[model samples]
Target: MKSMTGYGRSSFLCENVEVSVEVSSVNKRNLETVVSLPRDWQALEREILTLTKEVVSRGRINFSVKARVDKAERPEASWDEKRLRDDLEQLRIFAEAEGIPYHPDASLLCRLASGQKFEQSLPDPTKMTEGLKQAAQEALKAMIQTRIEEGKHLEADIKARNAEITCLVNELEVSSEGISALWREKLLERLRQAELELDAEDERVLREVALFAERCDVSEELTRLRSHGELMNQILEEDGPVGRKLEFALQEISRELNTVASKSPSTEVKRLVIEARAECEKIREQALNVE
Candidate 1:
């Protein structure tokens, strides 16, 4: 099992450029991804989303990238002194031939040098695909590691709650065993209170008790609850993205518990049913975060 909540980041430096990738995720009913990259790097979005889907099957995942060039190492920042001098010399010759003043002013030198300065062109994003891929992979691996670790804790909690629910169901079954006898006694007392003499062993009294016992029978509901519990255990033992299965099992268990609670007349049985339902709810909450 793996959790749906985690975060990771990695940085890659190469050729005087550094790229960083960060991946984070939160629980969701299905898989979703949001990618953030430089405008020129939009082409890489498909690759990133594909990689994320390879590892994550359920979550709202976010991927973001940041890149920067080392200013001191950039080729564009280098001065081409020879080119500047040649252009200035040609300009001076042109001025003399035209009978204009040949002397170059400080403003002219500054303007010519400025004109010779190289335009800062950013490196092509397509060329950095390998570096970006490496960073994204590392970040994704780290995120999955965290998710696995967190999943251990979640598994422990859910199993503990499941055990508690099972114990409560067992208690409810025990408490309901004598419910028919209790109902028979109550009915006899009611007849006496109304001043109507009815034998405890009367055919009509036995028939009424049998009908009442049939109505309060919770054996089927308890059997279904146990079956759901077994299904939950099977799901937990299996690998990968079992949240949906766990959720379904819990829902069925909840329904069975409700049915048991309604059929039983004993106060103790009702209390046990409530406790079991609470545990099921807690397990359901934990299952929501499982992947």
Candidate 2:
């Protein structure tokens, strides 16, 4: 079992460069990935997504990569004087032809210098690929472990709430017994007060009571509730991506509880059904974070 929320970070050295990766995730209905890499290393975004998919089946995952060379190993940024002069002359000619003012300043030179500075600091993606993969894997491992620990807590809470639902269902079953007969007796009492005598043994009265019982019967819904509960427990114990299955099971459980609430004539039965439904809802909310 695993949760859909977690965070992990790892940093490692690759040749003269230090590569760091951070991965985090939040609950989502389906799998999604957002990758953030240094502009120079953007080509690795697809590879990062593929690696993330291998570990996460569901969630909105965010991956970020940062790399820098050690100060001692960093190259000094220098401009090609001939190239810079050529570029300046070309820009001046274009500006004059377009009748636009052209002013070359220290800032412009610095801007051109900074471009080379940035490139000098960026490590080659091909050389950093192996290190990035290793760092990403380590970070993912940490995140998965965090998810597993949180999942244990979620499982415990879900199971505890499910047990509450089971107890409520049992109460509903016990309280619902003989409800049809009670309704029939009340009907007879009402008829007697109205000067209309209806014997309990009369064929019409018996048929009406039978029809009432059939309408109010919640036995089938109760049976399915128990079945759904068992299935949920099995789902909780199974390996990998149980959130969807758990959500489906909770939907079935909620449906059964609704049926029981609607058909049950006993006030106590309806109350118990409501309480069971509440527990199912709580479990459903918790299941949203499961993976």
Candidate 3:
């Protein structure tokens, strides 16, 4: 088991270059990675996304990579000879046509060329592919461990709540037995008030009572609930991304509880069903963070 919520950060500094990576995420139904790398190094976004996917299965992750290379390691602004030559030639022709002095100094030409600086840096390829990847790996390791620890705590809490719900289910079962007796008495009394004398063991009376009993019987629902509970426990014990499965199980449990509540005639049983629903709801909320 692992949680979808966690944070990890790592930094690698070599010579005059520094690289740092931060990875964090929140619960999500799908894997979504938002990677923010240095603008000059935007080409590395694919690598960053791949790295994040290797560690996370489902979540909206915010991954950011920051790198600082010293001035000595950065590529210097260079002039575009073709463009500069064309501009100079055009200027000379215009000056000649207007009889103006057009002798340009190196400073003016350099200023015009500075606007065309290369949109890239001069960092060592080995350091980026190897060092940065290693740093990202280390950060991901820490994050996975943190998520595991968080999942353990979530499991403990869910187990405690599940136990409470089980106890409530048991109480409801015990309380349900009285509904049948009360139902029979009510039927007999109503018949007496109408001046109809029917034996309790008569074929007509037995068939009618049995029909009512079947409507109010929650035995099957209780059995299914137990089975669903066992399946839920098994899911929490397994590994890998199980949040979607757990969510489906929760919906099934809620449906079963609804059926049980609607069929139960006893007020006490219905009340207990509501309480169980409440406890299970808490577990469902916590499950949103699972992965």
Candidate 4:
């Protein structure tokens, strides 16, 4: 079992650049991922998302990348001082030959100071892309480890609650005996209170009691509920994403319990059914965090 919520982080640093990746996830019915990276590295976002999909099949995942680079250390940022001076000298000679009054303003000097000052220094794009993917993958690996650890806790808690539900079911079953006779007696009492004359052993009364007993028979529901419980155990043992499947199975289990609750006339049985339903509700809630 694995949980859908977790967090991880990784940082990579070299002489000229330092980059870090952080990944966080939360419970969700489907896998949804969002990535934020340096604009220069935006092209690599797809590769990171692909890596995330490979590691996580369920959850709402959010990730971000932060980078710091020493611009002066890059070849691109180095000033072309020789080229700039050569161009300036040629322009000065042209002006002297044309006999024109030339003014070399600060703007031209600044422009010629560097080819592209705004563009920051960076490592090779291909290697940087691969590095980004690797960092994100490492963070994802940590996040998945955390999820697995949390999942072990969830599985144990759910299992204990399942046992509680089973106990309630058993209690309801044992308390359901003689329910038909009790309902028949109560029906006769109601008739007496209404001032109607009816023999307790009358053919009509016997037939009504038999019909009521058949209606209230929860044997099939009990059988199905137990079967569903066993199936739940089976699913927990298997691997892969089982949150949605477990959700559906719990719905079926709850449905069977509801049927049992409706058919039984005994207050004790109803009480037990309520407790069992509560346990099932807890299990359903926990399933939302599963993947």
Candidate 5:
């Protein structure tokens, strides 16, 4: 058992690039991965998605990769000498025409050229790709570890709930005989209150009541429920993804609980059935996070 909600991040440093990868996920019915990479690294997106699918069976997963080149490897800013010279020539001519004073000092020229000066550097695609792949693999491994830890917790909770439900089932069985006796006594009291006397009819009434008791019996449901619980435990203990299988099994358990609830006759039996159903619902909700 493993939870689908988790996040992990990793960073890789190559020759002149630092790459960071982050993976986050949430519960989903099917496997879906969305990757975000630099435009230059778009070709790697499909490969990354395929790798994720091989590792993570099911989830709404988001993978993000960010890369930055080392500052030392980046080009240094330099003055655009031609553009600055042209601008200064035009400025001097305009000053003379307008009869305004113009100081063509080194500081002024540098200030004027600042806007046009810029560094043009492109990151190495090969280095970035290698770093990104390493970061992504590390992040994926961390995410899977987190999910496995959470799965252990969920498995323990579901197991405890299954135990409680089984205990309740046993209690219901123990009280069933008492419930039948009470029903018979109640029926007799009602008949007596109605001033109905049927010496030959009493036997038939008892026989019908016994049959009704059998029809409303929950022994079969309890048996099946226990069996399902065992199977769920077995699946949880296995080595791979079992979310879909566990979910389907939980649905079956819910169906059985509903049947037991509907067939319940005595108030005590109804209450027990409701308790069992509540446990089943909890397990079902937990199953949604399994993987």
Candidate 6:
């Protein structure tokens, strides 16, 4: 079991360049990863996204990569002086021919030369790509570890709550027997108060009450609830994503509890059913965060 929220950061030193990657995640219905990298390293975005998917199954993950290269290692921005001068002369001639006043300045030429028209060679793409990918993988691994650790705590808490629910189910079972006896006594008292005589003809009425009691009985529900609890525990203990399965189990348990509550004639039994439903609801909420 693992949570969908966590953070991890890692830094790698490659030659004279230092690369740092930070990966953070939040709970989401699906795996959505956004990568923020320097323009020079944008070509590696797809690789980083793939690496994230490999490491994480679900979440809104944000990955940021920052690189600081030593001055000697940095790619210097340069311009083609000859090309700049020729373009400037051509521009001046064109303006003059069009009868427009042309103000050719050195600063303007310099700016034009520094634009995209000029070639700015970047660091080795292969090395940078490999380094960035490695750093991202490390960071993602760390983030997953953090999420797994957090999941341990969540799993324990859920298990404890499940145990409490089981205990409540047992208590309800014990209380149910007493509730049935009390209902029988109360029904007899009401009959006597009505001046009803105990006769062989009254057997039908007694049998009817017994049938009603059987219909209202929640023993089957309790049994199914226990089975569901065991399945839930097994799912949580398994070695992969089980949130959806747990959620399905929760729905089944809720449905059974609803049936029990609706059929219950005794106020005590209804109250116990409600309590069980509440616990199941809590478990459902927690299951939403599982992955």
Q: Estimate each model's TM-score.
A: 0.83, 0.86, 0.81, 0.80, 0.78, 0.78
Candidate 4: worst-modelled 10 consecutive residues by lDDT: 114-123
**lDDT preference between candidates 3 and 6, better one:** 3
Scored against the true structure, residue 141 in model 3 reaches a CA lDDT of 80
Q: Give candidate 2 misplaced runs (Cα > 4 Å).
A: 70-74, 78-116
Task: Residues 1-291, candidate 5: write the lDDT tens digits.
Answer: 688988899997765566788999899999999998765568878778877977899899999887666556756677668878888999999999999999899889767654443113435565466666677888999999899889899989988988888788787777665665667777777777899864535787779679878877878888898888789778888888998888888888888878877876777777887898899889888989988
lDDT string, candidate 4, 1-291, tens digits: 898989999988744688889999999999999998765567888898899888789999999988766656655566657777897898899999999878898898887664334224555556687678788889999999999999998888888888788777777778888889888999899989999889999898899999999999998888888888888888888788888878988999899988988887777888888888888989998999999
Best by lDDT: 2
lDDT winner between 1 and 4, please give it. 1
Give the lDDT of residue 191 in candidate 4: 87
User: Ranking by lDDT, best first?
Assistant: 2, 1, 4, 3, 6, 5
Taking the tens digit of each residue's C-alpha lDDT, what string does model 6 give over 20-40?
899999887788999887655
Error of 3 at 263 (Å): 1.0
Q: Identify the leading candidate in terms of TM-score.
A: 2
**Would you give me the overall lDDT of model 5?**
0.79
For model 4, what is the error of residue 82's alpha carbon versus the real structure, in angstroms, after optimal superposition?
27
Model 1 C-alpha lDDT per residue in residues 174-268, reported as the tens digit of each score:
99898999999999999999998999999999999999999999999988888888888888889888999999999899999999989998889
The collision pairs in model 3 are: none
Model 5 misplaced regions, further than 4 Å:
76-127, 200-203
Candidate 3 overall lDDT versus native: 0.82
Candidate 1 clash total? 1
Residue 102 CA displacement from its true place in model 2, Å: 20
**167-246 per-residue lDDT for model 3 (tens digits):** 88788789888787788889988999999999888788888888888999998888888887888888888889888887
> lDDT, candidate 1, residue 158?
91
lDDT of 2 by residue, 1-291 (tens): 899999999998877677789999899999999999876788888788888889899999989887776566667868678867887899899999999999999999988776556556777889877778888899999999999999999999999998888888888889989999899999899889999977889898899899999998988988898898889899989998999999999999988888888888778887887788788888888989998
